[model samples]
Structure formats: C-alpha cells, structure tokens
Target: MNESTRQSSEPETKRQGLSGNALGAIFMLLSGLGFTVYIVLSKTLTEDVHPVFLAFWRSFIACLISVPVIMRAGIGKLKTRHPGLLLLRSLFGTLGFTLAIVAISADFDLTFSQFNAISFSRSLFVTVLAAIVLRETVGIHRWGAVGVGFLGVLIMVVPGVFIFWAASGGDGFSLDLGTMTAIASAFFLAFAIVLVKSLSAELSAVALLTYANVLSSVLLLPFAIYYWSTPDLETWGWIIVMAGVGFVAQYCYISAVSVGDASFISPLDYLRLPMATVADLIIVGMLPGMNVWIGAAIIIVSAAYITFRDRNKKAQKVKVLTDR
Candidate 1:
C-alpha cells in the first residue's frame, strides 16, 4: 500500500480490542445521546417555563460549568483579535439555540423525534452558507447533493402537505409551521458554522465557546429575568442536569473529532436519529412518522457524502503540495 493509504488505515488499527474509529464512534454516540437528552429535558421544562427563559438559563448554566475550564486557559485566551467575527458567531449561535428551544416549546406541539429531525438539514444549510459567506467553490455534484438533501428535508417537513395542500385548504401548510421553525433554527446554526470556520484561524475553541456563553447570557439576561419564576426542586435538578450534560456533549463531539478523522466519526452522529426516536418512544410514547425517517436518511447520506468528498479533496490538495 502507498504511504497515503497506510496513513488512512492507521486510525483503524485495533489496540486493546478497540480501534480509534470504534472509540470515536462510541464518543459520537454518547455525544448524540447527551444532546438528545438535553433536548428532551428542555422540552419537558418548556411546558412549565418560557422558551426564552429556558434558552438563557441554558447559557447561564453552561457559563457556570465552563468557568473552571476557561479559567484554566487563563484570562488571556478570552481576548481575541477577531472581536467582530466572534460577536457575530455568538449572536448567531445564541439565536440558533433559542430558536431550537422555541421549536420544541409547547407552542409547536411537535413530537420529540420530529423536532430533532430538523437538525438533519443543518449540514445542507452549511453547504449553502459556505458558498455564500466563504466564497467556497462548490462543484455541480455538491450542488446536486444539496438539492437532493433539501428534497429530503421537504419530505420530512411537509410530507403530503405539498400534494394535498390545495385540497386541504391550506390547513396542512399552517400545521407545518413548527417544522419550518426548526429548519430556521438549523439555518442559523449553519450560519454560525461558517462564521466559526472563519474565526477558528484566530481563536481557540474554548475561547469561542466562552464568548458565546457570556455574550448569550448577557444579551438574554433581560428577557430571561423578565419571564423568570422560581423553579421547584425537581425543576432545578433538571436544569442543572441539562446544562451540565449539554456542555459535556460539546466536549464529546470535539474529542471525537480529535481522536478520529471527521469523515469516519461524523457518520456516527446519524445515530442520533434512532437514539432520539427511541427516547421519544420510551419517554413520551411517541414515534416518528415514516416521512421523518425517510427524510432523515436522505439528509444523513447527503451530508456524509459532502463531508467525505471534502476530506478527500483536502487530502488530494495536500498530496499535490507535497509532491511539489
């Protein structure tokens, strides 16, 4: 085998009866579980608590949890040269986070799996946003992938609505409002992803996260405090758990990528759909519609293809440079 082929295979080598890919898959699965659980916890609280307040407290608790870790990086890491990009990313991240909670709120009346399915579209959104914001070259293949992926999103979101909307007298369209909001949440998050790419050149991940938490808390403090009510003991327990687990989920994702190639580990994240489905079934006796499964599968495949292709393209570029 060539050096490149051997290099690629190294991550797959087993040690202690487990390979890096296996460990990465495990971590990604755990991260997905943590994230899904956090969403479920937030959904539970949204009935009794306002979404805005929930969003703010999530940031607040995350801020508290991150204190020691950020402190270890010292106050200096908190300072960044790219203040404008940082601020923009933070705002976008906060809005995305808040919108996600609102989508899962009682106002939406969506099933747990349905709400989580919206996130499948995020990678599609990121592709479009990258082209627009980053001026990246997107080949026709990727464009086709994006188009097909969004068809899947529509399938999951509106399903029969498009076919029957005129016959249903528009009621079907209105009923899809919740799903649309979830897609919008994904849009904002994809925008944040593009911004993070730009800022990563100058910022540590910890610094970026700290800024997001602090800024989100500050920006959201007024609204949260305005709607705040004293939570009962049980609610407090959920709040702490949600915050702590959510933060850990972020670390789990980071560590997963650090341990294995992004292409190998990213596919494992699709496990979240089944994980969320099972969670919904057990916790709320809810099951995702067939449309959601079909759509999610399409989105997952398209997103994985995009990631894999991008990794190969980057590797080829490196190979070309090395040959020179």
Candidate 2:
C-alpha cells in the first residue's frame, strides 16, 4: 500500500496485462482463421448439401462433442438456477448461426465488397441494441462513428449497382436477401455476445457453449426435418469437417473472451474479415478490391470506437458508484 511498493508493482502489472492481451490475441487470430476456413469449406460443399441442413447437423455434432466435456466438468455445476435467460441466449445463438451460415452457403459467390459491407452493419446494430435492450447509454461521439461507418457502406454499395456489372443485371447481384440474412446474423450474434457477457459472471464459458449449442441444435431440428436430404459420402465428409473445425473455432473464441476483457478481445474478431478475404483470393480467385478494404476499415474503426467509448463509460459509472 505504500508508495515504493505500489510504484514497483505498476510495471509488473502492466507487463502481465500486455502479455495476457498478446496471448488472447493469438488465440483470437487462430480462431478467426479456423472460422474463415469453415466459411470456405461451407461454400465448397454447397453444391451438394443445403446450408440449413448443414448448419443443423454440424451443430448437432458439436453438441455431441461438448457433452462429455460438460459432463466431465459436472453438468450440475453448469446449470444455473436461472433457466429463462439461458433459453433466450440459446435461441438467439441458434438463430444467428442457422441464418448466417445458410445465407453464406447460398450466396458464397456474391460480390465480396458488398458482402463485407453488409457484415459491417452488425457493429452499428449491436451498438443500437445495446442501448435499447441492455439500457446502455450512448453519446454523440459514438453515434458519429456509426454514421461515418454507414456512409462508407453507401460508398461501396452505390457503385456496385451502377458500375461495370450493372450491364449484366440490375444491381449486379447486389441486394441479395441472403446477404441481408447474413447481416442479420451479425446483429443476432452481437446481441448474443452481449448476453453471454452478462452471463459470464455467473456461468463458465464451457457451460454457456454447451447449453447454447445443444438447445440451438434442438431448435433447428424442425427445419432440418422439413428439408431432409440424405448425405452422400462427399456431403458426410464436409459436414464432419465443418462440425469438428467449427466447434474448435467457436470454443476457442468463447474461451478467449471468457479469459480476457471483452473490450480488448472483441476487436480481434475483425481479423476474420481479412482472413476470409485472403482465403477467397487464394483459394477461389476472388481478389476483393479497394472497396472491400475501405468499407471494412471504416467498419472496424467504427466498431472499435464504439467499444472503447462503452468501456470508458462503464468504468466511469463504476468509479462514480465507488466514490459514493
């Protein structure tokens, strides 16, 4: 508590914080890469299996994978007395995955620029939802960043509709409903993330994942039943790959945030944009041009700005309450 002791501890604390951040960043980076690969592989398999069916089965497999682990940890320990909130979180999580992956598989060949542009909208959605649903406050500065981000979206989108590809068709394959669904996936995922954060103080990350995946799989079963298609050997191979790798990526990501500050860790999620872009360029020969980067840059900047402001506001509130 003395000056000399506190001064000596400052450097040590800072170093440890930085080290933790670095480790968390590496896990996030790898998790992002795994998810990027999942998207690519999902695209590769869309020729055979519907994305809805694919998402459902993969989630089912993930549930199976996580069960033994959850049981080993003691399922009784995982169960919170609060069941309703857990159900809502799982429902949102399920909708997010089912809609997003299905949309991606259906429209993997859409303009990457527009695709990425729509992806950016999720940050804005999350910010707005945080205010409305979580009762979080937002000030003018963060709102300004949201506006600038949307302006960048217009820049990327306007040209695609009127440019070279316009001659091929109206909107040049822009305005696809699947693209919008993917964007909705981002919104739902963000909201689900916020819920997960709220629950983190009460539940272990593994427990939350176990509940979410299993419940989501159950919710999607009706859809899967309606669209049932027997998986051939080729389809089975991709589903297994998607299930295994996607589970790894998803678990790593959830664990990353569980062990670190969300404000510090969430920004690393943006790394997926570049990873997917590069993978598409290398594997599928889709070189996303300036528009993708420009729009994505704007979105990433805006999302980071929003998170930073929120964290500061939250810390200020804590300080105020503690002062009283």
lDDT (Cα, tens digit) per residue for candidate 2, span 1-324: 999999999999887765666777777887888887777777677667777788788889999999899899996858686688888888888888777676677455554334545666777877777778888777899889889877766555445622454354324435457666777787887788778767888888788888888898998899889878887897798788888989999887876775668798889888787777777678767766555566678778888888788888889999999999
Q: Pick the candidate with the highest TM-score.
A: 1
Off by over 4 Å in 1: 1-19, 159-175
Alpha-carbon local distance difference test for all models: 0.84, 0.76
lDDT for each residue of candidate 1 in 1-324, tens digit (9 for 90 to 100): 999999877765643466678778888988999999988888888888898998998899999877678899798877778888888998899888899988887777777777777787888999999999999999998998999898888877774733443454334333366777788899998999899999888777887788888899998999998998788889888888988888889878877877888999988888888888898899878787666787788888899889998999999999999999
Candidate 2 segments whose C-alpha is farther than 4 A from its true place: 1-18, 106-108, 111-117, 157-173, 318-324
Model number with the top lDDT: 1
Q: TM-score for every candidate vs. truth?
A: 0.89, 0.85
